[model samples]
Target: MPIFHKISLRPEVENYLKQSFMNEEVVSASSKQEAERRFEALLIHLAHPPSFTTVRVNTHLASVEHVRGLLLNELEKQFSGSSVPVLQHPALPDVLLIPVTGPRRNIEKQQCEVIVGAQCGNAVLRGAHVYVPGIVSASKFMKAGDVISVYSDIKGKCKKGAKEFDGTKVFLGNGVSELSRKDIFNGIPDLKGIGIRMTEPIYLSPSFDNVLPSYLFLQNLPSAVVAHVLNPQPGEKILDLCAAPGGKTTHIAALMQDQGEVIALDKILNKVEKLKQNASLLGLHSIRAFCFDATKAVKLDMIDGTEGTPPFLPESFDRILLDAPCSGMGQRPNMACTWTLKEVTSYQPLQRKLLNVAVQLLKPGGVLVYSTCTVTLAENEEQVAWALKTFPCLQLQPQEPQIGGEGMVGAGLSPEQLKQLQRFDPSVVPLQDMDTDCLGDAKREDMIWLANKDCIGFFIAKFLKCKSTEEKVSRK
Candidate 1:
C-alpha cells in the first residue's frame, strides 16, 4: 500500500514533467493512457524510499565476504536478533543488498506527536534518526524517553517553536524523544544531536551511523554502478569533475588499487575537505582533492606549471567522470519540492559548461562518463544528444551490466543512441506492499531485481573520445 501522498511539485514543474512523458516521441510509441499512467506512478514512487538499501563494500580494505559477515553481525545487533538476510549482488561483485521492510502499518501511534522538517522526514524513511535541528514542533510537555508519533511537515506549513501544529503533515513513524521539548528549543547555543530515536519506523532498515564505516559505504545502487561503468584502471590519471564528498572519487581510487592519481575537484572548500576525509577514511592515498570550479579548470598556456592542481593543460587526464550537479528531483522519500520551473530547468547550461571543460581535459581515446540523479530530459538524454553533436570526436559507448532502462524518449536521440544510455525509472516497476510475514521466504535474485528497478531516477551516458584524423596523421 502506498502510505504517503504523491510528491508535491509546483504547478508549472508538474506540467513540464507531464509534457515530457507525453511528448510526441513517447506517445508515438505508446498510447497516451499508458504514458499518463506511468507519469502518475512516478509521482507516487518519488514519495517513497527504495525497497532495499544498497551498500558498497570497500573491497580494497576487505573482501566482500568478510565485509558481508561483519555487516550481518552488526545488523543482528541492530535488529535485536531479528533475522535480516544480507545478500551479495550477482552482477556487482563489490555491492551488497539488504531488504528494507517497509510501511509497517500496524505500529501503534502514540498520543503525543512530534513534527520534523521534510528533509529530516526523508532521512527517517531511509533509516536515519531525527536530529535536533530538524525538529519543528513537539508536544508541549513531552519528556525524554517518551514514545511519540512522528510526522513530517510536507508542505512546510509547520511553524518552529510551536507546541502543536494543525497543518498539512504526514505521519512518518513512532520514536522515543531523546530530549525534552524545553531542552530542544529553549534558546540553546548548540543543540545538535539526535532528537528522536526511531523505535518503530514505518520502514525497518538498519541505520549505518558509525557502523563499520570503513568497510562499507551506504550508497545508492545506481551510484555504485557509475564507478563500475567508468571502469578506472590502475595507474591511469583520472579526473573527477564536480566531485564533492568524494564517494565516486574514492571508489575510483579503490578501483585503481590506489596506484594512479585521482584528482578530485569541487567548487566548495568544505565539500573538498569532506572529499579528502572520505578518501582518508577509505584508506585511499591516490586522491588529491582541490577546491576549484570545473568550468574554469582548463589552462590555455602550455608552459603554465602548477603541480597537481587545477588549471591543468588540455589533454592531461586519461579518463574523467563528470557526475554533474543537478536539480536532484529523483531523490526518493521526497514528499514535496519547492523549486520553480526556472530552478528545475537551470541545470542544462551549467552541465554543458562543465562538460566542455571535461572534454578539453580528457586525452584522446580516453573514456568519459556523464551522470546525474535527475529525471529531466534536458539534463539527461538531451545533454547526451547535445554532447555528441557538439564534440565531433566523441561517440556514445555501451555500458557494462546495463541494469537500467534505455534512455528516455523526447530527447531527439535515435533508437540506437538511446539504447547505449541507461536511465533508472522507478515508475516501470509497480509498488509491492511489504509482506513482513513472507520476508524470510523471499528469493535473493528477486530481491536484487526489486532493488535495481525500485531505486531513485538516474541517468548515465558514457562516451569514448577518438583522436581527430588530423591529430592521428600528425602523430604518424
Candidate 2:
C-alpha cells in the first residue's frame, strides 16, 4: 500500500516533468495515457525508498562474503530476533543487498505526537533514527523516554518547539523520545545525537550507523554500478570530476586494487575534506582529493616543476568519471521538492561545462563515463546527444553489466544509441512487497531483479575517445 501521497512539487516543475513524459517519442511508443500513468507512478515511488538497502563491500580490506557475515550478525542484533536475510548480488560481486520491509500499516498511532523536519522524515523511512537536530516540535509535556508517534512536517508548516501541530504531517511510526523539549530547544552548542529511538518504524530497514564502517560502504545501487562502468584499471591515472564525499572515488581506487592514482576534484573546500575523510576511512590511499573547479582544470602552459594535482596537461588521464552535479530529481524517499523551474533546469550548462573538461582531460583512447542522478532529458539524454555531435572523436560504448533500462526517448538518439546508455527508471518497475516467507534460490533471484530495477532514478552514458588520425600519423 502506498502510505504517502505523491511527492509534492511546484506547479511549474510538475508541468515541466509532465511534458518530458508526454514527449512525442514517448507518446508514439506508448500512448499518452500510459505515459501519464508512469509519471504518476514515478511520483509515488519517489516518496518511498528503494525496496532494498544496498552496500558495497571494500574488497581491498575484506572479501564480500566476510563483510556479508559481519553485516548479517550486526543486522540480527539490530532486528532483535526478527530474521532478516542478507543476499549477495549475483552480477555485482562486491555488492550486498538487504530487503527493506515496509509501510507496515498495522502500527498504531499514539496520542502524543512528535514532528520532525522533512529531510529527517525521509531518512527515517530509509531506516534512519531521528537525530536531535531534525526534531521540529514535541508535545508540551514530552520528556525523555516517552513513547510518541512521529510525523513528518512535509509542507514545513510545523512550528519549531510548538506544543501541538495540526498542519499537514505524515505519520512515520512511533519512537521513544531520547530528549525533552527543553533539551532540544535549549541554546546549547552542538547537540548532536539521536533524539528518538524508533522502536516500531513504519519501514523496517537496518540502520547502518557505524556498523562495519571499514568493510561496508552504504551506497545506492546505481552509484556502485557507475564505478564498475568506468572500469578503472590498476596503474592507470583516473580523474573524478565533482567527486565530493568520494564514494565513487574510493570505489574506483578499490576496484583498481589501490594501485592507481585517482585525482578527485570538488569546488568546495569542506566537501573536499569530506572526500579525503571517506578515502581515509575506506583505507584507499590511491585517491588524492583537491578543492579545485573541474571546468578550469586544464592547464595550457606547463610549469617547470609541478606535482600531480589539477591544472593538468591535456589528455593526462587514462579514464574520467564525470558524475555531474544535477538537480537530483531521481533521489528516492523524497516527500516534497519546493524548487522553482529555474532551479530545476539550471544544471544543463554546468554539466556541459564539466563534460567538456572531461573530454579534454581524457586520453585519446581512454574511457569517460558521464552519469547523473537525474531523470530529466535536458540533463541526461539530451546532453549525450549534444556530446556525440560536439566531440567527433568520442563514440558511445556499451556498458558492461547493462542492468538498467535503455536511455529515455525524445533525445534524438537512435535505437542503437539508446541501447548503449543505461537509465534506471523506477516507474517502469512496479514496487514489490518483500516476500519474507520465501528464502530459497527463487527469492534470491527475485531480490536481485528488484534491486536492479526498483532503485533510484539514474542515468549513465559511457564514451570512448578514439585516437585522431592526425595523432596516429604523428606517432608513425
Candidate 3:
C-alpha cells in the first residue's frame, strides 16, 4: 500500500503538464509509454520528502568537520542508541546528509484527530512540528494534553474551527496537542507556538529547531550546489538578484570569505529584512540587501542610484545570481496545488525581464547563474533557449559537481545544449526510504547519489559573458 496519495492537481493543470511531458519531441526521444511513466513518477515523488535532510556548514566561522561532530551528537541524543550515520558528500565537502527513515509500516493512530493545512503537513514530513497557526480544524471536545492523530487537508476544503472534515485528508501520524480547542480557536490573543508536538511521525527525520544556529543551515542538496557553481572569489563584487531568506546570498558571502562585497536585492521589504537578519545570524557581513525590483536594477543614462541602494551602473557586478520567482511546482511533500494555467504560465515573461537586467548588470567575462524551482519547460529549458537566442553575449557554461541529469527533451534543445543544463528530476529514480544502520561504503555511496537525484525538482543554467576581455578580472 502507498503511504500517501499522489499529488492532486486540477484537470486543466494536469492536462497542460501532460502536454509538456508527452510532446512530440519527448515522445520521439522515448516511447510515449515511458514518458507517461516518468510523468506519473514525478507526481508520486513530489508528494513525499527526499530520503535525506541536507544541511550546509558555514565554513567561514566553523569547519565542516567540527559542525558534523556537533550535529552527530545531537542526532544521537534525539534517536537514542540507533546508529544514524552522517555522511559527507565526496564532491561537496561542506555539505552533510542525514538519511530520512520513512513511511514506517506501524504507527499508532489516535481516535482524536487534528487537521492541518497542506503546507504544514509537508513541513511535518520534513521534520517540523505543527505550529499553532497551521491548525485548521480540531475535534469538538479536544483538550490540552490530548493525544491526537494529525492529517493534512490535502484539497484545502477544511474549514477553520470545524468539528469534522470529510474532504480528502492524508494521515501524518500522531502527536500530543499542546493547546486546547478553546485555547486555539477562542483565545483572544491569537494562539502561537507549537500546537502539536509530534511523537510518532510516519517519516523519521530529526528536527533542526535549534541545532547549531550559526554553524548549520537547513538547506536542500541542490541549493548548496548553486553557490559552489557560482564560484564566488575573495574581493569580487557579486549580485544576488532575487535574494530572499539569504540561502544563496549567505553562501556566496561565505564562499567569498566575507572579503568582497555582495549586493543582494529583493522587492519585498519584509523578506529583505529577514535575509538581512539571516546574514547577521550567519556572521556574513559582505551581503548588502535592498528592496528594489530587479527588473529596474539597471541605472538609466549612466546615472547610479543612491550609494548602498540598488539601480547600480551597468556591468557593475563580476557575477550575478538570478534565482527567478516561478510557479514553485517542484517543492516536495506537496500534496495539492490549486493554481490556474494562467498563474502557472505567468513566470516566463517576468523571468525574461530579469534575465535582460542580469545580463546588463554583469561585467564582461563575468559568470551568471540562472535557476528556478519549477518543473515547467517554460520556466526552465525554454527559458534557456530563449536566453541563448536573445542575448548574443551570454554563452552556456558547464557546472562543477554536476549531480543532476541533463535537461528534459521537450524544449527543442539539442542533445549538446541539454547536456550543459542540469535538471534535478526526482522522477529519474524510484522512491526508496533510506536506512543507514548497516550500510557499507559501496551502498552508502549509491544512497548518496540517489539522495541527490531524488531531491526536489529544480533547474540550473550557468552562463559566461564572452565579451571583450579588457576589463576581465584574472580568475586564479
Candidate 4:
C-alpha cells in the first residue's frame, strides 16, 4: 500500500511550524538536517490515522472487563467473526484499544465517483461512512444501491450538486450509494443520515455508529490521558473550561465516580447541548453543562450568581481542567488544512485567558490540568512557561502514567521542567506493522506503548495551586 500524502498546509503556516520544530533549542540538540527530517515525518504522520483506535469505557455504568467482552463480540459480528482483541490499558484501566488495519491496496476503483468535503474525508478515514450533509458532488446519474468510488475534495473548491469535479481529490475507497442524486439534490431541506454504506475503505477502522452508546466513548489515546492526568477525586467540585461535547468532562466525572460536581462550560449552545447528550447517554449525572464563555467564568461577587451556575467566585473548585481551544493541526487523516497563518496562530492568547481563570478558580493545593489537541509550541510549551512565570502560585506537577514524550526543546523550559510536561508526538516512532502472533503479555505491553506515541499530536501539562489567597498567591 502506498503511503498517504503529507498533510497539505498553507505555505506560511508550514513555514511557521518548521521553524517551531527546528528552532535554537532544537538545533542545539541535533543538526539542522535531522530537525527538518523530523518535521517532514510529522507532516506525513498527521495525514494518516493511528494503528489503534482508542475508546474509554463508562466505568460509572459498566466495568471495563464487562464492556471489553461486549465490544469484542460486536467487532466479531461486524468483521465476520474475525478475532479482534479489545485490549485494556494497563495504566488507564477504563480505556480500551482496538487495532485498525489499513491502506488495503487491492480494491479496484469503480467508475462512478462521489466527492466529499475535506472534513468529511477525514471522518471517512477514521471509520465513519459518508453522511448526506458531507456529500459535495455525485455522479450525474448515480442512484441508490449503485457501487460508487468515494473521493475527498482536498482543496475545498468542489461545488455542491455538480455532475463532476476536476479539483484535487484522493481515493478513499468504494461504497454503495444510499441515495439517488435526484433524491439528494431534489429540493430536500435538512436531509440527514448516512449517504454511503462503506463496503470497503482504505483504512479498516471500526465504525461505532450507535454501537454501545452508553458503554463506550470513541476517544484518541492522548485525549483519554488528559482526564487521568487531572486525577479528579470523589466528592470534590471540579471545573472543565471549554468543555463542549465533553469527552474529557465525562471522563472526569467517571473518574470521580459521579459523586463530584463537574461544571462544564462552553460558549456555543449547540455544543453545550451535545455535551449534555453525551453525559446523559453515558449515564454520568455529575456533569453540569453550561453555555457560557470561559474567559468570563470567574466572577468576583459571590452573592450575585446562583449556586451551580457560571461566573463563580474564585477558588471555588478543587480541581480544574483547561482543555483550551487550539488550531487542531494535530488531528490524524487530515487530507488538508486551509487555515491562514493568522488563523493557525490565533489560539495562544485565548489559551492564556482561560489559564488565568483556571488558576484563580483552583483551590489551594488543588490540581489543574491544561491541554490542547494541537502541535504548536506557542500553545503547548510556551504557554506552560508563561503560566509558571505569570502565576507564581501555580507550579508544574509531574504527570502520572507518562506515555508521551517530554516537552519539545524550542520553548525555553529547562530539561527538568520539560520532563513534567507530556507531548504526544507522532513522529517519535514510525508507523507500526502489527504482528500479533506469539504475543505474550510483555510483548503486547511494548506494542501498546508504541501505539500510544503514534496516536495523536497532543499536549498536557498538570499544575498545583500552592497559595490560598489572591494577595498571597506566591510560591516560595
Candidate 5:
C-alpha cells in the first residue's frame, strides 16, 4: 500500500545520517540496525506527500464557513465533481483540510516518458501542474497532445533536452504533453507554464493555483499551527527570523487583522521579494520584509532602532519566531538529499546565532518559537536542550493546541519539557489513517481530529523569557 518507494541516499550520506542518529546526545538506539530502519522509514515517507492539504482561511478577510464553502466548491470543480470530502479542522477553527487521494495503483503508464526535475515531481505529488522550467527532457519525437508517462529524475543527473534517459527515474503518473520539445526550448531563453496537463496523477491533490487567492492560503498544517501557537494580537510588534515566502508572516499579519507590525527577514533577496509578493497578494500591508542575515539583526545602540528598520536594540519585539534555516530533511516527496555530514550538521551554529539574536530582540516576558522542517535530533530536541542550557533566562512554554507528538527522547530534555514541545514525525504515522471512508470511522476520527496532531515533519519549541527582576536589572 506504499504510494512511494523507499528512496536510498548515497551510501556516504546514509552513513553520515547513521552517525548523526548515533551522535552522543542524539537518539540512543539499542543497535545500529534500529537506527538504520528508522532512517530508511524517513526516506520512504519523504518520497510521498502528506495525506491532507491544509489551507488557512483568512478569517479577517472572509468568514471561515463562507471561505470553506467557496473552497469546497472550487475543489469539487477542480476534481471534476469527485466529491472529495473537505473537512474543517476540528480544533483549528480557521483551517480546512482536503484529503489527498493517492497511491492510486490502477493507472496505466504510457511509453512516452517526460523526465522532470525532482522538485517539480514533488510539486506534482502535491497537486501542482507541471511547468516547463522543470522539464529536463521529453521523448525526441514527442509533440503536443501526445500522452506520456511522467517520471521524476530523482538524482538530478538528467541532461536537459536529451532524447532518452537511462539514469534513475521514478514514475509520477501520466499526463498529456501541452508543449512539443521544440516549443519548450524555442523562442525565449527560459521556459514557462503548463508543460503537461496531468490527467491521472497517482496522488490526487487539489491544486490551489489562482483559486480563492485572498480567501485562503495553502500552508502546511504544522506551519499553520505555529501561527496559532504564537497567538499574536492586534497592535503588537512581531519578528519573524528567516521568514521567506511569507507563509507564516502573512498568516501573522492576517491573524492580527492587519493592525500590527510584522517584520520578516530572510538572507536571500529573491526569497524576500517573494515574501513581499505573497503579502501583497494577500492584501496584507502590515508586513515589512527585509533581506538580511538574521544573526546580525540586533544592534547595541537604542538610536539605531528606528521604525520599520532593523538593527534594533534589545527587547524591541513583543514576540519573535525563529523558523530557522535547517537541513530540510523532513520535506516529503523528497527523493534524495545529497548533503554530506558536514553540510547536514552545519545549521547548528547558524541556528544558535539566530536564536541568540532572537532572545536579544524580544521584549521581556515575550514569547519565542523556534521551528524547523527537519527531523534531525540536532535540529529539534537537541537544539531545545542547547537553548535551555545557554540561556538561563529562557524557559520552555507549553504550546497552545498541542497537536503534534511530544519531543523525541534522546535530547536529554526532561519529560515535562519534552511534553511542552511539538515534533511532527511524518515517517512515524501511516497514511491510511487519512483515507476518505475512514472519516466515518469514529474511533480513528477521534484519534486525528485535532489540527495540530496531523502535520508535516516539523519541530516547534515555544519559550517565555523568565520574569526575574534581577535578570532585568542586570541587563539595564
Candidate 6:
C-alpha cells in the first residue's frame, strides 16, 4: 500500500502529466489504466519521503567506519537512547546510510494546532523540527511550553497568524511549543527561534538540527550518488553548471581532496556566493565560483586560449556536471503543486541551452553528466533521446557505480541504452523496515549498499565526447 494519499496538481498540469504517461509508447506497451496507475503512483510517491536518509562522511578528514560510529552514537543520543543502526554503503566508500523509521501511523493528533508552511512541513517529514521562521500560524492562546499538534498547510492556503486553518492540511505530528502565539507573531516584529520540538513525526528520521555540523552532511541518497558518479580526480578542471547552494559542488571539491580547480557557476551572484560559503564551511578551497549565466559561457574571442575565465573558449573543462534546473516534480513530501501545464513543461528548452554550453566546454574524451531531480519524461529520458540524436559524437557512457535503476521505458531508447542511464524511480521499491539481522555481516552491508539505489526521483545520463567527430559533426 502507498504511504501517501493523492497528491494535488493543478487541473491543467494533471492533464499534461496524464497525456505524457498515456503517450504513444506508454499506451502501446501498457493499457491506459496501467499508465494512469503509474502516473498516480508518481504523484503519491512524490508527496512521501524516501525510506532512508544518506549522509556523506568527510572521509578525507576521517575514516568512514569512524564517522559511522560517531553518527550511530549521535543518533542514539538524538532518539533518547534508541540504538538506530547506521550501516556502511558497500559500493560507495564515503557514504553512510541510516534507515528512516516510519510513517509512524499511530501518532495521535492533539487539539492545540501549530501550522507550518509547505517547505517546513516537507522538512519535518524528512526529520526536522519546526523552526519559528517556517511557522505559518498557531492556535490562539498557544503559549510557550504548551503541547501543540503540528500540521502542514500543504496547499499553501493557510494565512499566517491565523488561530486555525480549515483549508487542506496534513498532520505532521505533535510537538511542544517553544514559542507562544504572541512571541511568534508579535515578539519584537522579527524574532526568530525554535517554534516546536517534535516528539513524534509521521516518518521518523533523525532531525539533524545542529547535531553534527562539521562532521556529517545530510544529503538525499541520489544527490550523494551524483558526486560519486562524477568521480572527481585530485587535480582536474571541473564545472558544475547551475550549482546553487553548492551541495554537489562541495561534495565534488571534497572528492577532489581539495587539490583541483572546481569552477562553480550559477546565474545568481548570491547563489554563487553561497557555493563559496559552503566550500568554506566544509574546509574545501579548490572551488572557484562564478556568477555567470551558463548559456553564455562559451566565447568566440577566447579561441586564442589566453582568454581564461568567465567566457572561456570551447573545450575548457575536463569534466562538466550540468545538474540542470528542472520542474522539481521529484521533491518529496510535496502535497500540492499549483503549476499550470505550460509552467511544468517549460524547463526543457532551458535545460537544452545549458546542455549545449556544457557540451561545448568539455574537452574531448571528457565526461559530461546531465542530471535532474524531476521525473518528467521531457526533462529526463526525452532529453537523453534528444541528446543522442542531436549530438552524434556524444556517446552514452556507462556510469561507474550504477546504483539507481535503469531509465524509464519510452523515449525510443534501447534496453542497453536505458540500462546505461540511471533513474531513481520512487515507486520501484516500497518503503519497509528492514530486518537488519536477517543478513550476515557481508549481506547486511550489501543490502544497505543497494539501499542507495532506492532514492528520490532523479535521472543521470553520462556522455563522453569522442575525438573521431568534429564539433560540427558533434552538433549535427
The segments of candidate 4 whose C-alpha lies over 4 angstroms from its true place after superposition are: 302-304, 433-443, 472-476
Q: List the global CA lDDT of all models.
A: 0.91, 0.90, 0.89, 0.89, 0.82, 0.81
What TM-score against the true fold does each predicted structure earn? Answer: 0.98, 0.97, 0.96, 0.96, 0.93, 0.93
Q: Compose the digit string of candidate 1's lDDT tens values, residues 1-476.
A: 58888999999999998998889989889999999999999999999999989999988899999999999999999999887888898888999988888788889988899999999999999999999999999998899999999999988988898999999998889999989998898957578989999999988888999999888888899999999999999999999998998888888999998999999999899999988888888888999999998999998776858667888878889999999999898898799999999999999999999999988888889999999998988899999999999999899999997989999889889999999999999999998666557677777778888989999999999999896423544587
lDDT of 1: 0.91
Ten-residue region with minimum lDDT total, candidate 3 = 467-476
**Superposing all C-alpha atoms, what RMSD in Å does each candidate have to the true structure?**
1.5, 1.8, 2.9, 2.3, 2.6, 3.0
RMSD of 6: 3.0
Superposition error at 191 for model 1 (Å)? 1.1
Residues 300-360 of candidate 5: C-alpha lDDT, one tens digit per residue: 6556446668767678889998999998887776776667778888999999999999988
Task: Output the TM-score of candidate 4.
Answer: 0.96
Q: Return the lDDT, model 2, position 253.
A: 98
Worst 10 residues of 6 by lDDT: 433-442
Q: Between prediction 2 and prediction 3, which has the larger lDDT? A: 2
lDDT of 4 at 393: 87
* Residue lDDT tens for model 3, 1-476: 34777888888888888899888999998899999999999989989998889999999899999899999899998887766878899888989998888787688888899999999999999999999999999999999899999999999999999988888899998999998988889985666799999988989899999889899899888889999989999999999999998999999999999999999999999999999988999998998999999999988765544765778877888999999999888888798898899998899999999999999889989999999988888899999999999888889988997988899887878899899999998998888855444343437778788778889989999999987332333442
- Model 1's TM-score against the true structure: 0.98
User: What is residue 37's positional error in candidate 3, in angstroms?
Assistant: 0.4
For candidate 4, lDDT tens digit of each residue in 1-476? 22678999999999999999999889879998899989998998998888788999999999999999999889998888877777888988888988777667778999899999999999998899999999999999999999999999998999999999988999999999989998778847878889999989888888999999999999999999999999999999999998988999999999999997999999999999999999999998899889999999988764775877889888999999999999998888787999999999999989999998998888999998999999999999999999999998888999997988999987789999899999998988876544334233336776588678789899999999998756644453
| CA shift of 195, model 3, Å | 0.4
Q: In model 1, how large is the Cα lDDT of residue 203?
A: 88
Top candidate by TM-score: 1
